[model samples]
Target: MESSDTTVVRASQPPPVQHEFALRFTSTPRGARLARRLVSHRLDEWGYGYESPVNESLTLIAAELAANAVQHGQVPGRDFRLRLTATSGILRIEVTDTLTERVPPQSVPEVPGDAESGRGLLLVDRLATRWGTCPRSAGPGKTVWAELTDAAAW
Candidate 1:
């Protein structure tokens, strides 16, 4: 009998999967509210349930950032943009507005016990794995971004 040789060939790995959602909203409170709602909806569609901690956290973060954009970054005739991207085990949320003058603090600020506001960024810092701000790539504004990592999403 002739000797037989065995060989193995490995398959190439497929590209990583990614999901993205982007939209522009008017620089108004109503628009901010809508941004929060749509963020939750999109995450749910991406397999993160409405009640999932990841989804809830992201929704809340979106609300905070959107509210900030509306209240602080509003430009008379310009709209704000919201973008959500999920890739591998990370989810990134970005809110861009047309007012570059206002930038979020680098560190969490202490809020007075009786303060009615100024707690949004604190909540975002707590809920998000990491967060920061940057100038918008294609416009005259800043983009506040937050990221959360959940292995379950992988």
Candidate 2:
């Protein structure tokens, strides 16, 4: 008599998944606040908890970039765009505005000790694995982007 046997094998790596969220908001302080809240909500939907470090960091980055867009990049009758994309163990957050003349400084600037503002990008630089500004792909504006790489967060 002959015996039957079965062999099982599993994939060494899981398939790559990509997630994206994009929206345009009025260039106002209220809009900026909404952008930050939505980013946290979307990240929660994508598997990161509200209290997770990844969620908190990305939410803060979104708030800062959105605030900058409203304060410095706002244009009359124009809106700003917020985009979030996660793929291949990386998460990218981008804020695009209609104002093109103003661009973010290449390096973080020193803030006066008594200044009431101007520390957003500094916080972004510290939290993001990578961050920068680039001309908007299809419009007259700039897109400030920051990326976080934490495999466990995905």
For all candidates in order, the CA lDDT equals 0.94, 0.93
**Candidate with the greatest TM-score versus the true structure:** 1
Task: Report residue 74 deviation for candidate 2 (angstroms).
Answer: 0.3
- Would you estimate the TM-scores of all the predictions? 0.87, 0.87
Give the true-structure RMSD of model 2: 7.3
Off by over 4 Å in 2: 1-17, 151-154
lDDT of 1 by residue, 1-154 (tens): 8999998888968446599999999999999999999999999999999999999999999999999999999999999999999877889999999898999999998899999999999999999999999999997999999999873753
Please give the TM-score that candidate 1 achieves against the real structure: 0.87
- Residue 17 of model 1 has an lDDT of 50
Q: Which ten residues in a row have the lowest lDDT in candidate 1?
A: 8-17
